[model samples]
Target: MVFQCQRDSWARQFATRVVSCRAAELRPEGGGEPVRGFQPDDRGLIGDVPVLRVTRRGPEAVHFVQAALEPGAEVLLSLDWERRFDHMQQHSGQHLITAIAEQMFGFKTTSWELGRQRSVIELDTPSMTAEQVEALERSVNEKIRERVPVMVRELAADDPEIETVRSRGLPDDHAGPVRVVDIEGIDSNMCCGTHVSNLSDLQVIKLLGTEKGKKNKINLVFLAGNRVLKSVEQSHSTEKALTSLLKNGPGEHVEAVKRLQSSVKLLQKNNLNLLRDIAVLIARDFKSKPVQSQLFVLHRKEGDSEFMNIIANEIGTETRRALVILEQDPSLCPQETLLFLTVGDEKEAGLFLLAGPVEAVENLGPRVAELLGGKGAGKRGRFQGKATKMSRRGEVQALLQEFVSHGSPEA
Candidate 1:
């Protein structure tokens, strides 16, 4: 058969604009040297990788090359093989998964998506639950344990054995032996993407999660082999910490965790009580102050959402117009990253200004954040995010003084 030029896909995929690179001599197979000087037909191919034809296709120079040995013929090699393995694994695994999903759940692997970072195999079954996905994962991995060789065979068009083929379909322009990959009695398909020679090559296939589609197209996300190994290592480390927290040996880990759960609930209630008392004391202090304008202050690391809300209400309660900047506190650490701020109308805009540094002033949001060693953005007179560290009481009181000393902030 004569060689035909297939359309190179490299052009469309990358919008690259590369400058010209000169070619040196084509070295024959035998010599180990760089061939010293340039040869006329000595294209970029011969030195390390020998050539058949050099075709300049768009940005990259695609070499129509063959191995230096017998049957040394044309094949494609590209430097950018980044993440192709994931696609191959997904497509290949789709076949195995589809085959097994049919047997176990009576559902077929009807469609697939070869994502750039992950792969998906859609199942025909509708309304798949989390439990079903877990079961599916277990069953597929069990099949892979069989270590059945994935045999790839090319047969003539007239081959009668084609009837016995587990092929899902035939390829285009069927002229030569049909390439069929068979996993013993399990699955068979006509595909172009490379696959592992045996099921065992897919040591561990983890189903990351799933999505829903029409007619119940259950799409699955998966990680294979090395990816699974990394995931497992992470899980093991977490469990090890959990065991230490439980204060029980691994055998009693479950009970220890339950005990911890009970303790956390008790702590939550006690914490709430403490915040209530703190709110009352702070509110009384505000009542004692002779008001010039409404005061709305934000303190980092000082407390939780409840405390912030309580203080905000206490400060604004007696104000004739009423306004405050009560920031929410974390149920745990008040200064922990959270959506913790309040905004009132411009009529009470002075209350907004009270956020001075802590929000003591309006336009100085960035400076307040900077003083706290943090980063953030704001517009429409409202802003919020995390600081590198929460402001202490003395630090917050100092900022309050600055706001009192200077009236309205500069825009």
Candidate 2:
């Protein structure tokens, strides 16, 4: 059936009589079970109610109204002009690009999507070159400038002229005659989507480039009419922002950003070296103490796994007599805190190594981790993982001290 939307794409308002009204079960917001007869309003006249959507149900054009209505009520349907116009521009633009691409490069369009922001057409080619894209855009816009007429023809399903037009076949539930959209001197295809009456209505088309698709296909992206202008405005705004931040012209933005990234990398390498040196010194200071404590705890505002490992290596076999816990500042990461706990006297230590009394180290390591709202695992004497409540660090410290003095964290 040729609906009003397809017959006259330019129509903004439609007046129709409701043949039937029934409660429908619609999917609820955020998606769960469908809600039956979810009426947001009471029964009303045509002008008081609004049509939410109009779709084809079998051979009938169904209107999903926002309010309850009798079987024979008349309603005035108002089209969202802006949205409808956008669809028209993009749908017609797709036809132009699809036709020109096949004509120039023999890249037939397999399918296309009229996306909310932009439109994409999948061509039956493995790839598309920049030169081909440029040529396609030029040819499409040229036809638009020439103001080519777009006509629609409805013929019987067995019409002889149907063989001359491009078609992907009709749907199983399709009824009535076949509708073909013809672009004069360009191409003709069987379609049911709304389209502009003239190529000029597309205003202009900008080929945004291509991306790889399934089965060795290429999807070409594009924008038409007001979308092109909007895209240009957004791109210019971004360029201006980049120019201001980089203190360079738009042409130099790439080089400026590359140099900045190189400088950041160098600074990070130097910072890591300095952190390693600091870790060594901290380990040496604890080892050199006249009377060594049983527990050694150190917290740094900024350090990663590498920094913690350096300190553990410097401690060496000292872990046999002391339990060391290294932690990043809890306040720095209020959500989750990183921790490294090692209790071993081995010369070469792995992460979270435990070399103390089998029972003491095993019990203390995991228990302390639990106190900080986290979980950890260790074989000899090492425990490491993230904690959600590092604010309970004091309790974990006390537990460690008790374990060192009494041979058990619980005691």
Best by TM-score: 2
User: Which ranges in model 1 have alpha carbons more than 4 Å from their true place?
Assistant: 1-92, 103-105, 113-120, 128-147, 154-179, 203-215, 220-238, 289-300, 321-407
Global CA lDDT of candidate 2, please? 0.74
Q: Give the root-mean-square deviation of each candidate in angstroms.
A: 13.0, 8.3
Say which candidate scores most in lDDT.
2
By summed lDDT, the worst window of 10 consecutive residues in model 2 runs over 330-339
Q: In model 1, what lDDT does residue 70 have?
A: 19
Candidate 2: where are CA atoms >4 Å away?
20-56, 60-70, 290-301, 320-411
Q: Which tens-of-lDDT digit does each residue in 1-411 have in candidate 1?
A: 111111221111222222233344445556654443221221223334544445433323444334331133332333333344444455567778777777778877666776655577777766677897799889889877877677666667688877875555753433445666677788776654456667787786888877777665777777776567767888789888977776666788888778878999999888779868977786677567654333344443335545655655554454322222222333322111111232222121211112212343345566556555555665433444445534332353455446555644333
- Tell me the RMSD of model 1 versus the true structure: 13.0
Q: Candidates' lDDT values, in order?
A: 0.54, 0.74
Write candidate 2's Cα lDDT for 1-411 as tens digits: 788777888887767776677777666456798645423221122455654545566567665555566656666666778888898899999999999999999999999998889889999999999999999899899999999999988989999999999999988899998999999989899988889999999999999999998798999999999899999999999999999999889999999999999999999999989988998898788678766566667656556666766776676546433332224343332111112343322222222322234466566667666666656676644456555565666676677666666665564
